[model samples]
Target: MGLEPDNMSGSSPEDIVNAVFGHFDPKNPLTFKDEQFNSDPILSEKALCLVYILGADTIQFTDDRLIEKLQTVRQRISEKEIPQVIVMTKVDEACSLVRNDLRKIYSSKKIKDKMQECSDLVGVPLSYIYPVKNYHEEIDTKNDIDVLVLRALTHIVKIANDKLLRSDFNKEQPLTYKDQHYSCDPELSDQSFCLVYVIDANIVQYTDDRLIDKLKILCQRKGKTDP
Candidate 1:
């Protein structure tokens, strides 16, 4: 899902908080209910990744307040282990060398400077920052422009896909017992497992109820034998 605020430059702390957490105060960090994000139709769930789109030429001109707000949002999202990337647009407009020859994008000192500035300002790593030219004025698509956009998209998709698969595995494979009482149903279909590890003499007494419960879940998802 995508969410675009009406005025990013003038966005207040409440606006940013509301956009991310669905309301002013979230009960849990990065946890959301189906009805929580009803304020914005686009925000149905917690974001898998955050993408900040900025103009390459206007990075220096960005308001200080907006930068601070973005930093705050980035910190909150990072706490949940969500990935973030910056897409620096209008690279051709920012650098004369890149404007003349798109191949010079990587070699241009000005473009590199702008990207570094954006990285430093937004607190995102330079590697996650992608510089590209928007297809605004051009009537036809260019190969170089396409290459830059495709590379950025490839990385973004890989990260998002990794997170999605991880979340699915975590939800479905673990924590089968939900209620206060724990019970196993033999009639239920069994899940496949590949490995099992037995407790050692020294560790047997050290395993408590909580630890055993965790081990039981792991064994159920990862072993062929019953714990």
Candidate 2:
């Protein structure tokens, strides 16, 4: 599922990547659900504020504010169990904010003037963010909007397929490590495991070679490891 819409800017990277179909509706602007946007335990009010700035009726999605939003998005992504793809649209306009050189947007003289404030807001490297625009062209009977959408979808699939995950432990009994939980069905179906780590919960991570042995010892002492 996606996080939020970027209003004038378009969908976020995470939204773009996660969406199976449909991009943000330019007509209907809205923010992310408070429950999901506030998912990260370490996320501060500033993070929410950055998102608010990006998707608000005002703020114009400046590079500085955009960078801060991207950083918060990255932090939110890291906290999630899945990798995310962010797509910031209407970037054709942001190009005007750059200096004449334009070798890199952030390196441009205008953007450089606000570097300190931008960095303070967004704790992410500039290299990771990508800016793009989708303008409907009438000059060509067969325009490339569909192609761009297809390309975006293909890229999202690639990212989803390339996500880094914990090594499969299919053969072994699922263990309690980090926030991973394990429970058996009385009907004897396959076990279920939910590992929503990187967020706060009353979960445990006691499972190194030594720690596993120690836990086994204690479980056995209390008769919690039989069967």
Candidate 3:
């Protein structure tokens, strides 16, 4: 139900909640945890909506082919599962880099169009994309991290409450939703974020722009690239 820096060694419930303190604790070494799923197999099998988040400190958004890479990330998410949210945190940095560039590239219509393109290619709905604020770069501090933890916890509680509500009903089968092969009977939580695309006023550059351009061209040649 919560997200934080983890040591990778399993721990008790309290350990999970306080794990953030351990990693972000100034006294501890620079710590990082791979995205993981809780080992409750019963819960594991249930397809929980994924929260895809991009972070700061680890994010490097600047320069060439960034949009192309973003497209690729969108592709990955669409391929994986319907995303609960696609958080683009450290947005201040993104904005700072290219004052108006980010907006220009990420217009509402443009985004929808792009997502639709990705969905068509990946064969999924474009409705699942969501965004949130979860970074601290300009007004740098750990508050952003705190916000991320709280948001994750909120999502977890919602899932738990759903289970509680279903238990009260005593139904043979619990209430759930489906996305392709995904079944939300068991709750699952997934987190993700963006990295390395530089944006400046009126200009957005991709770190891997050249490569994506070439690839985009290839896709275009094959009659893709409508978004």
Candidate 4:
């Protein structure tokens, strides 16, 4: 999501934060979409993960108000179990060691300190923060820069997959089968599921009772075999 210019001044931190996360709140629903107001409902529900792009060189000069808003956003996303990552760009401009030798990113104390500062400010873990050089002057893509970006993307996809697997409308309710209820399994993660039943649309209403019973039996067997 893009933030309006500071001169616009009409959008408050609370407004922006609410527009993003409030859609998931059943108590207070945003019923309308306003481009001028920068409001889009159901943003949180549609987004698989949140990615915060920060300039590594100017992180120290980040505005206090923006930081506070981000902290609140982080808290809400954490409560919902959505993954958030920070891509700290312009790493070369942030540290001289990394600028001279891209391989020294890990060993560069300055880069590490900047990453830690970002984590402390945004409430995001250090592991989820990636420092990389944004392609500004380079006419060609560099392997070192691509590596850092790819690593962050890989982590984001993995965590997002975990969230998707755990997501279900009935997750809060107990698993029930034929009046039998079972507690939701908390250990479920990285699981895959695919169960499809297709019948001719024209004949769907005329499906035999015996066929329906067979389908139910198949569903029960599939559930039993699922890990």
Report lDDT (CA) for all predictions. Answer: 0.74, 0.40, 0.40, 0.74
TM for candidate 1 is: 0.61
Off by over 4 Å in 1: 1-44, 168-227
What TM-score, over all chains together, does every model reach? Answer: 0.61, 0.31, 0.27, 0.63
Ranking by TM-score: 4, 1, 2, 3
**For residues 11-118, could you state the per-residue lDDT of candidate 1 as single tens digits?**
454445455544433443222353543444333454667788989988898777677677877888776567889999999999999999999999999998998998
Off by over 4 Å in 3: 1-40, 43-47, 52-107, 121-124, 133-136, 140-227
- Model 4 lDDT vs. the true structure? 0.74
- Which consecutive 10 residues in model 2 have the weakest lDDT in total? 43-52
Error of 3 at 14 (Å): 29
TM-score of model 4 (CA atoms): 0.63
- Can you write out model 4's per-residue Cα lDDT over 56-89, one digit (the tens) per residue? 8988988786776677677876776778889899
Candidate 4 vs. truth: CA RMSD?
A: 14.5
